[model samples]
Structures are given as structure tokens and as C-alpha cells.
Target: MDPWLSMYDFTYHLAQEIAEKIHERNRYLRNGENPVKINLSVRTLLKRLEESIGQLRDSLLRSVSTRQITQLEGDRRQTLIDELLTKERQLQMSFKGDGTEPDVIRSSLMSGGGAGPSPYNPWVLEEPEETRGLGIGDLKQQQQRMIREQDAGLDALSNIIARQKQMGYDIGNELDEHNEIIDDLTNLVENTDTKVRNQTRHVKLVDKKSGSCAMMVVIVLLLIAIVVVAVWPSN
Candidate 1:
């Protein structure tokens, strides 16, 4: 059953009782002049009551989440993961690419057999003039440039990729949790609504009885008037 609806039920009945009392008090007001103040303290009381309930609501919601998660087993979790992946893919696709190409220059420099040290395996620059016939000075300058480029490239890539990965994981978990929560809340709300409808039907039944009683009273008065008229006819 929905804890929220149960809580609301408690609160609603209290409000109804207070409203009935207020109505009864106003019914006896003399001359219908200078309306009685409804004791604004009622508002303060409700506010405090809401604050107290809010704490309970929070605790209950957490408990619901935990129960839902626990019920969610391997298949469910996997399904949730798949759903999350689909959403993540859609998000990735929605972002229009800025058309920036990969760092090809850095790629060539980092690859083996380049004039510079391998980025993945940085080593002292061997004199290339003796092998590939490229001047050592030119090779050294190129190596220095490649090294700087690789350093900058690595720094830029590290944070962006890491942050994106982290965000994907976080969003997936939250979505799964949120879905479970909605399911639980929906069930609870449906049950509460059923109860409210039942209560309303009961109220209507009472009103119908009251209306019938009022009609009977009216009919009796009319009969009395008819009897009085019939008896006065001789005068």
C-alpha cells in the first residue's frame, strides 16, 4: 500500500473534522454580521504537521527505494543497464559534432619509427643521421615538438574521457532507481485513489439518507397545512 496515501488519509480526515467544526460555529453567528475569524492558528498547525510528515515521508520513500532495488535482480538490472545504454547513445547522437578531426599529427609522431621518441614508450632520442640520414638537429627539434604535442594531447584527453565515463555511470544508476520509484509510487497512488473513491461513495450514501429525511419532513408539514385548511372550511 502507498504510505503517502495512508499519510494523506490521516491528514484529510483531520482537516474534514476541523472544517465541520468551523461550519457549525458559523451557523450560529448573530445577524450574519462581522464574520468570526477562523483562528488563523489552524494554518500554523497544518504547517507544523506537514513538516513532521515530511520527515516520515522522506524515510518511507528511501525504504521504498531500497525494497525496489532489492527486488530488482540480475535480469532486471541488466535490462536497466541496456535501457540506460540506449538513452546514453541517444544523448551522444544528439550532440552535433564540431567536425574536429583526430590529432593525426600527434598520431604519426607517437607511432613507432618516427623522428621522435614513441609516446607510449618515451626514450632518449638516438642520432638518426647515421640511420635514416635525417640531420640529428632537425630530428631533435621535431622530437621536442612531438613531445610537447603528446603531453598536451594526453592532458586534454584524460579529463574529458574520464568525466564522460563517470557521468554515464551515474546517469544509468539514477535512471534505474527512478524507474523503480515511479512504479512503487504509482501502485500506492492507485490504491489510495481507490480508497478515496470508496470514502466518497460512503459520503454520498449518507447524504442521500439525509436528503430523504428532509423530504419526509417537508411532506409531513404540507399534510399538516392541508388538514388545517380542511378544518377551517366551515368558518
Candidate 2:
């Protein structure tokens, strides 16, 4: 299985677990549970989901360097990561009495909505029909949870963008390396061409000197022959 796809599949499983836990918690919260109790917060489940997402991101980054995955595949992996994030945010908004639509989590996870009263059913969740009265302390804790949710999501997004930038740098570095090799080859060719031209020029100069020496010897021999013939005829 593709690393990214496998990680994304696991995220859905985690999301299913969180949905069941939320249902169970809300079932209790409505029946005399303390309004101020945040000890049962699904915050832990959310962290697990985030870790799954982080692993997916890490997997994709590794594939880029080690497997040399294409840009298109990388982009699809990124889309899956973003989808998981969207699911997480929707899940966070899924408290009972929050007035959120039933499909908030279901539609994000699966196109087929959900099933039976079993909390184990994927995306099957239960929430209070109306907001429960909360003490000031509970309200504060809820506020803090929301803030933390936003920060965690942002941090995840920041890490993803940073990894993408790093990938870009890796591509650029490879291009620089190729360009350097090309440049070295070009210089080698030019240097070889210059040496060949110099050798040709030296050969031509040697030929010119040899021709001059031969012409001088022939001229001297002709002059000596003319003097001998003239002197014998005079004698």
C-alpha cells in the first residue's frame, strides 16, 4: 500500500474511534454528569488523529527524496492530508447541542452517511439535542479547548508548508547539480578544441620552416652548378 494512503486510511479508523467515544461521553454527560468535568475530553483522541496526520506528512516527504515520487502523486498525498484536517475540525465542532448538521463528520469521512445506533458504526455519533447549561468554569475550559484546537491545526499546517518548501529546495539543489555537470562538460569540450587548434597551428609552422630550408638548399645547389659550368666553358 502507498505510505500516504495507508496513513490516511488509519486516520479514518481513528476518526471512527473518536466518534464512538464522543457518543459514549455525551450519553453520560446528559445523565447527571458534572458540567465542569473536562477530564473526559476527547482531546486525547484528537491528538492521536493529529499524530496520524503528521506521520502521513512524514511519509510523503520521505517518498519524495527516497522514492522520487512524481509531483502529481505528491499533490494527491497533500490533498488527503488536507482532507484529514478538515475532518478533525468538523469533529471538534461535533459536541451535542452545537447545532452542527448530522453529516458534519460523516460526509467528510464517507459519502454514504452513517448507520445503526451502535456507537461503533463509522461516523455514527450522538450529541445532546440542546446545549446544556454550563458553569463559568466549564465555559472557560471549552474556550481553552477551542483555542488549543486552532493552534494545533495551525501548527500542523505550518509544518506541512515548511516540508513543501523543503521539497522545493531539494528539487532546486538537484537542478543546480545537473547544471554544474553540464558546465563542466562544456568547459572540457572547449579546452580540448583549443588544444587541437594549437597543435594544428604548430604543425603548420613546422611545415613552413621545412619548406623554407628545402628551397634554400635547392637555390644554393643551382648557384654552384651555374658557377662550375661557366668556369669550365671559360677554361
Candidate 3:
């Protein structure tokens, strides 16, 4: 297959594979329970898909010279692939079976410029331990800070879902409005076409009638002139 075709095919398959992995993870779970194992499995598959996407992109770029590829529609595809690869790298650093510290992961995220949770595995549910702090005031301050961070993360996820819903609704409404306008225009054009045909027929009828009348008038005048000459016995 052609390099561009292969790139497109790889992208399609990658998306399909991601979707399948997500579905598989969901199927293994029951109710609202969060399965850390399933989440990790899905993440691992996602990582592989990212790798495949990177390979596809690199292959495409290598096959097509930069001058030829720059103006190609694949420019957007390549950019998106780069972004996914970057996210995958960050995820690998944070969640890979290395048991990295959350603080280190957070620092890595800040420096690496990746979004979402800290590179540390958030799904790792650890039991709470007794805090032997110096004062109650300090403990309360820490609790409030943690609550604020959780709230911020929830708000961000909520906003993303809401925006996607709004975009879908907007597209649906635009398509309906466009179809309505097309229907109305189609009707108007048909009616106008019918009216034009009727006018053309009417004009042809009037021309035929006028021509018949002119011919009759000419014949009558000639007969009258012949009668006058016959009665006067003209030289």
C-alpha cells in the first residue's frame, strides 16, 4: 500500500483498537466499582496504540519529503499524533510499574508540560494512616488543600464533558436548519420553473392568434380590390 494510505489505515485501526480495549475493560466490570486491574490493562493497551501511532507517523514522514508533505492534509494528523505520543511518554513515566512517588510525578508533570493527573498512579487506592501532626490547625489546612485539588480536577472533567455535549447539539441544530433551507429553495425553484413554462406557452398561443388574424385581413382586402376593378371595367 501507498505510504499515505498506510498512515490513514494505521490511524483508523489505532482508534478502533483503543475503543475495543475500553469496551473490554468495561465489560469485565460490574456496577460502578472501579477495577484498578482493568484500568491498568486499558492503560497498557493505550500505551501500545500510542507507540503504533508514532511508528505510523514516522514512516509517513520518512516516505514523503518535507516539502511535499507540508501542504498535505496529513499535517493535522501528524500534529495530533505528536501530541498523543507526548501524553503517552508522560503516562509511561508516571504509571509504569516503577511505584514512583506522587510528589516526583507532580514535579515531572509540571516540568514536562503534560495535562491530567500527576504521573503517579491515582488509581492506586491506599489506606489512610494516622497523622501524628504538631497541631490541629496544620492538619485542617492540609485537608482543605487536598479538597480544593479534588474539586479542581472534578470541575475540569465536568467542563470537558459539557463542552462536548454542547458541540454535538450545535452540529445537530445546524444540520436541521440547513436541510430546511434546502427544502424551501427546492420548492421555490420548482414553482418558478413551472410559472416560466406556462408563460412561454401563453406567448406562443398569442403569436399564433395574431398571425392568423393578419393573414385573414390581407385576404379580405385583396378580394375587395378585385371586385372594384371588375365592376368599373378598368382599362
Model 1 TM-score is: 0.27
Query: After superposition, which runs of candidate 3 have C-alpha atoms over 4 Å from their true positions?
Result: 1-151
Predictions in order: lDDT: 0.50, 0.70, 0.62
After TM-score superposition, what is the CA distance of residue 72 in candidate 2 from its true location, in Å? 2.2
Relative to the unseen true structure, what is the C-alpha lDDT of residue 190 in candidate 2, on a scale of 0 to 100?
A: 100
Order the candidate numbers by TM-score, best to worst.
Answer: 2, 3, 1
Using lDDT as the measure, the top candidate is 2
Clashes of each: 0, 0, 0
Quote the positional error of residue 2 for candidate 3 in Å: 52
Total clashes in model 1, counting residue pairs 3 or more apart in sequence or in different chains: 0
Could you tell me the lDDT of residue 181 within candidate 3?
A: 100
| Per-residue lDDT of model 2, residues 1-235, tens digit only | 8656776888888877777666555545544465334424577778888888888888888887786799888888888687677667766766433322344444444533224323343565534434345544665687689899999999999999999999999999999999999999999999999999999999999999999999999999999999988888552
Sort by lDDT, best first: 2, 3, 1
Model 1 Cα RMSD, Å? 43.0
**Each candidate: RMSD:** 43.0, 23.9, 21.9
User: Residue by residue across 6-100, what tens digits does model 1's lDDT show?
Assistant: 65455444433433333333322312333334434434434544554454446445655677434444345444334323322322221122212
lDDT of 3 by residue, 1-235 (tens): 6666666566555544544444334323322345577667758777676767768777667745655555465677676666556545655555443322434543444444555555443222222344232234555676788899999999999999999999999999999999999999999999999999999999999999999999999999999999988899656
Residue 66: error of model 2 in Å? 4.4
